[model samples]
Target: MTNSPDILSNTFPDTPQRRLLLDFVADEADALQRGEQGGFWPDNHHLISPLIGKAGKFLDEDEHVAFFHHLLRLDHCPPVKTEEDFALLLRAYDGLGDLMSRGYPVCSLPFHLAVFLFGGDALARLPAEPEPTLASFQSGVSFLRYARSFAHMPGIMSKRQKFIDLSADRALVARVRKTLLHGHQQLLDGLGRLWLWAFVFLVLQVEEEAQPVIRKIREDAAAAGDVKRVETLERFIAAAGLAR
Candidate 1:
């Protein structure tokens, strides 16, 4: 991600709200596609960070938090040109969630992938199924883990069931888990890097237009000894004409 203008924006066309939904979708898809092809896509991931920063800014200052809230929710999908496409994506996510909740097997793999990548609200409704493909299986495990963590994040007060051994398909879960635990670290790292790149762009831009919240992020990062956020903070400060 090179902080290119091509990746900027905060809303999908046709949606009621202004969100960088397309940029987000593009980044996530880049991660997965890169994982499949044995690499990373910096440009794809770089496209969304400013939007994330914008969402953060709006969340801090805008009275209409719903729009920004929705923007933050778009981490699941890669970028799309229109909200109509996003609506289809939403349906797939909801359908997949319902399928997972019913304890169906790998037949619902596409839906699972769609939901996790697209940030549709209905993922919690899906039943767990162990898809056989290398990508799907690994993604399934990661999805559950992330979902569990997301459930615990601030402002996400959903009562979805945590992923436990359902006993219905322990063998599959165990098999996929073993595989993912062994060689999937790169994928995770790539995803994190993608997000980091975007965050860098966000912090750099937002601090100039919206300072207070970015300052708070810096302070919190300092208190927590969160070295990883340093790059983002630096970019923001520099961009804001504050200091590196």
Candidate 2:
């Protein structure tokens, strides 16, 4: 845990973190199931709690790692050299559209899935020589867009799939349940809490960048009093963490 800059610092969907985010995603299905079972699931307010909680946990771990190890040193890594490069890295990942329909676990991470499963072409098209900043901003934007998209999945999925089918093969209910029961001990080998911490580090950073854009989108929606947009933003924020 000492300051080792060699750690891969890149950006979103830091595979490990993405895995943790996906794990939390299981809760949405669980909450829907509980609600159906007549449990006292609150309204949207109940939804945000899980997201913030999961995100907070992830962030807490990331902070610890950073405190002990320092930022990842990816000097040779071209994708995260600058903000633009970051954006492009994420934009390049737009390829996940195909995978999302298949319900791959990566789909749970949305943008990361897009970047991981779909970014080949964009990446290939890079300035042949590629600049560190070329895609960073775009990638950041993609992260924001994808983060926003998370909010819709639970509501949409809840409506689309039956609760039983959603949680059929699952065990955990809310994120709290999963954390309390397994902690990181249960995560699959090579990918567990560490991965999630990376994700948290990346997103918390991205959220800082995304806030202005997200706020702009919200303000635009508010100016027009767009109820749908507000709801969508709320859902996106909530779902981004798989908390709600």
Clashes of each: 22, 33
Which segments of model 2 are wrong by more than 4 Å?
1-152, 155-205, 241-244
**Runs in model 1 with CA error above 4 Å?**
1-85, 94-192, 206-209
TM-scores for every candidate against the unseen true structure: 0.26, 0.21
Best-matching candidate per TM-score: 1
Candidate 1: Cα lDDT at 227 = 65
Candidate 2 global CA lDDT score: 0.31
CA-RMSD of model 1: 20.2
CA lDDT of every candidate: 0.34, 0.31
For residue 191, model 1's alpha carbon misses the true position, in angstroms, by 9.7
lDDT string for model 1 (73-109, tens) is: 3323423233433343343344333333322221223
